[model samples]
Target: MFLQNVFTSYIFLVLGLFHVCHAQHITTSLEGRLAFPNKTPFNITTKITLNSGEYTTYSRKDGSFIIYDVPPGVHQLDIDSKAYHFGQIKIQLLEESMDSPKCLEYAYPGAPKRVVKYPLVIYAKGTYEYFETKKGVSIFGMLKNPMVLMMLFSVGMMVIMPKLMEGMDPEEKARMKQQMEAQKDPTQMFSQMFGELTGSSEDQTAAGTTRRERREQRRVKNQ
Candidate 1:
């Protein structure tokens, strides 16, 4: 009985030691990406704070960051970058293990909301139309002039000529042909065109004949 009691006491002592060790040692890990409001990845400096002290790290080019072996306790995590807004999180750590540690991740929310009493803006000053009571000094009068009419015609020709030339190119012709072939079915095209030319409803054509024409032809044949 004494030997069994001794072994039991030893077991309890060992268990207590194990618990104390687990409480003292902590494994902390950090993982997250730094990004701008647009969600584009960016490198940033990260700081982790514990009860004992604080440590700093930097994010990778891909914006991912990681830190390990932080003392087990409450911590404040901060991530900052010149190109993006800052991010922060609070974490608590308790024990240490060889197993994968929990990572505190962070991402910037975006530009902060603000109330602007008066947003500064600038407007260019110019008169849209200048008019004079003199014989030919009216805004509409200028458009009626031969010089202004010729200028408008020249501008229109310059804009349209390039597009017209592009359509005549062999490559454009082939591209148009391919597009037409992909979009068109001969039977459907024929049916649509015939319906339009004959002024018949699509449903009537689909049913094989117009009701009035069918009735008239049948009556004529019977007579």
Candidate 2:
């Protein structure tokens, strides 16, 4: 019984260590083609650096390359070939497992080409991913989903509704604009809505009186 207990504890310890190691280390492939300054793809020698250290890989006949078994961290990669220009990128490793290899293409001047750059930053809490293309557009990959689209739609409606309603009569347009502005603050919106719903002219009169009294008080105080 004592030997069995010891074996069980040892097995558990080994399994725990394995799980921790699995969680800490990650492996992913980087696959992309290399192109010359003239926008022609060619076979190239690729060097990937992890954490500023020298790492090496090779591109296939089609100028495609893959780097596997990359640990979780920031990596600086360089791709070079005798026939093509050199390209460099910075990558962040965060996911426990990744299968989709990043694809990078080259761009040259005088010819419209797509240049892809992936710069990933990993934080303790999460990872931030961004990409820049030769077309002068930067994309944040994490926020490019449907939920963000819905949020943008809601905000667009909130901004455009007041302008659309402004085509009504002057008095109605002014009232709607005031209502929209008042909704910007929850406390002000609640107070105004309550006053309007209850037909409370007392609050309005009190507000006017308070303003006038404050002006008089300020004048007297200044005197």
Candidate 3:
């Protein structure tokens, strides 16, 4: 009985060590390539990361990269490039080295699985907007603003309509005058009745809308 108990204990110890050793050797290499648009300038310092900062690798001059000894599990593979942006991909690897690799959409996890070829073919989305665009208030940009356009329209109507009304007879001129006064600019009327719906003000609502505006939105849903 004593000899049998020793043998049983020895077996369990051996199995535990074997399991640990096997898990340690289960790592595989993650491979992928970085591609950019034709004639797009790219720096040679592009790097790839897995599971945030668990494992990191840099791409070669020819845009090829590999993360060595990646442990078998799910990982978020991402590229780090200053001038460009790349898609975040979800990669899953199993214990079997023969298990083929696939890229899944990391951003939309609940969406359908998007399986792509192994040795991932990563493409550039576009360049990052590093600097704020120069805002010197050009005539074209100001004209695009709702407030500016409304003001210009109201001024033009006030100036031109009065002189044009001079040619009309008394009844016609009075009718035209009433129509002009009654038909206030819809934009101006909304601003006065509800509140400022647009433009950048320091105390403006974070959503660019007020509680009343949201109620108005829900009201307009039937329309």
Candidate 4:
């Protein structure tokens, strides 16, 4: 019976030591909610950093926070907002657990206090945006079209014709100047142009007829 009593005492002594060690290792935690003025826990983000062990945590979407395993002592609680201005606060943690939520409220600066005002940003459609919507055809489609080739050829002629005239000999320049003067009278110019075309056609016909006649005469002599 004495041996059984001693065994029971040893078991109770071991359990007591376990309890004491668990209580000594108990850690403290901080819970809080951050909010902006006249708002219910805005979606703004908040950063909390405890100087001890450099522990840190960001606030939830509802502006709630829970920092675990905080060292129990006087520590600097550095607080920062992603969209507001609430400086830091010093926290004195003396308890193993804090169930009451720490509530913090901050206000944004007034419009007059805003020194760096950002300009309004906007996007405008370009003038050529409509052409882009046509799907490749409106932009480079003309490059492959016959009309574009004709237009380019006409423009090239217009550019080269003046340079050609400038480089002509003095006699050719005189002739060209006379032609320009003739062009001043549109009626006379059209009449003269038509006469020249008909005269050249007649001369070609006459030369072809003379050649045929010579061939006929040669055949007769051979026969």
Candidate 5:
């Protein structure tokens, strides 16, 4: 009976030591699953992380994952997926177990804590837009450029202005020549030329033509 009593005491002693060791080494795990709006092939890139990657893990074929040994503190949880985007989750953990994760977007004080359901099932809100949306070499874009507009205006003026001068009254033509010769600033001259071509300028010339050719001096408008 004494031998049996001693053996029982030894067993009890072992149990106590194990309990103490367990208490010392205890850690918490976070359980979660990734959900897709559509079927996506599981790849190495699909992963869950906590505290900006102090702890991270990948999902299984079924999209379920468990992040093990999460440090007991505040954490920002994120699911990194190239195929889709997920929402941020915030958590405050005690040493032994995980508390319900809150929606990081609404984690401000005085706001109601949005406690996420346990064994978290995070859903993909939208697919990642990885494709380039830019268009290639548009003609309208080139025509919109100021340099191109200026070049076109110069070419049209060089071809058309000679004919216009030929049909003008000698007094009006000589007055227009004097006004063009007086203009010294190239940028101001370019702006004035562009204004005249676009029909924004007044019909009266710089020399103030008193002739009936003042009506003809206005910009050639499109029918």
Candidate 6:
């Protein structure tokens, strides 16, 4: 019974030692703020990787950031911003004492960038207008011109209306086609109307009868 009691005490002692060593390797935290070239604070996302693990965090509008449980070693820090570009940087972390905290401040090296530039003109009248005119009628011109827009709309309707009328009855479609064709022949309709209004129909008929009578007389004379 004494031997068994001694063995149990040894087991408990080993467990306590292991717990102490584990406590010594406990996690550490790093806190910091991000800044710009002009010392302006902006919201940003950051990705950090170290031998311990990978972590991601976002800085608030005030540019404050905090990362927890980072191992003491070399790490990679990446700042995420499309307009403001940043390359990866190597970060060094030191072992944190139980009484002290690791705090840092970081600044993004990127600044504001312009993507487009307009041409400069000086001492030349109409030079810009001349260059624009050389490019000739663009799609914007067609869109803005009422006559061109009307023609485009008419052509579009011509293409779409046939398909729409396909679902219509054949008799209705035919009648519509006839009416459109008549409307298209404005000159012929106008001539018929003028002839009726001025009695030109009677004049033309009388003229034709006289020519036939004259032709008959000439035939008789020739015989």
Cα lDDT of candidate 6 equals 0.57
Instruction: Point to the candidate with the largest TM-score.
Output: 3
Q: How does model 5 score by TM-score?
A: 0.45
Q: Which is superior by lDDT, 1 or 5?
A: 5
> Which runs of model 6 end up more than 4 angstroms from their true locations?
1-25, 43-53, 96-223
| Cα lDDT, model 4, residue 111 | 25
Model 4 C-alpha lDDT per residue in residues 104-212, reported as the tens digit of each score: 2212333222111111011111122224444555647777899998999879977887898988986577556656677789986786577577786356446756898
Can you tell me which runs of candidate 5 are displaced by over 4 Å?
Answer: 1-29, 36-44, 51-54, 68-75, 80-86, 92-115, 123-135, 158-163, 171-223
Those runs of model 4 whose alpha carbons end farther than 4 Å from true positions after fitting are 1-24, 96-223
Across 34-82, the per-residue lDDT of candidate 6 in tens digits comes to 5555555455554433333477766566656666776666565555544
- By lDDT: ranked, best first: 3, 5, 4, 2, 6, 1
Error of 2 at 180 (Å): 94
The candidate with the higher lDDT, 2 or 5, is 5
lDDT of 1 by residue, 1-30 (tens): 999999999999999999888766656565
Give all TM-scores, in the order shown.
0.35, 0.35, 0.55, 0.33, 0.45, 0.33
Which parts of model 3 have CA positions greater than 4 angstroms off?
A: 37-43, 107-113, 132-223
Report lDDT (CA) for all predictions.
0.54, 0.59, 0.76, 0.60, 0.72, 0.57
User: Runs in model 1 with CA error above 4 Å?
Assistant: 1-4, 23-28, 43-53, 71-73, 80-85, 93-223
Could you give candidate 2's per-residue lDDT for residues 1-223 as a string of tens digits? 9999999999999999998988776566655455444544444344444445555676666556666667666666654433334434555556743543242332323444333543221111112245554554445754578898889888999898868886788656756766778878998889888888898845774676689889999999999
Off by over 4 Å in 2: 1-15, 43-54, 80-84, 100-223
lDDT of 1: 0.54
Q: Candidate 4: TM-score?
A: 0.33
Model 4 weakest 10-residue run by lDDT: 116-125
Q: Candidate 2 at 147: error in angstroms?
A: 75
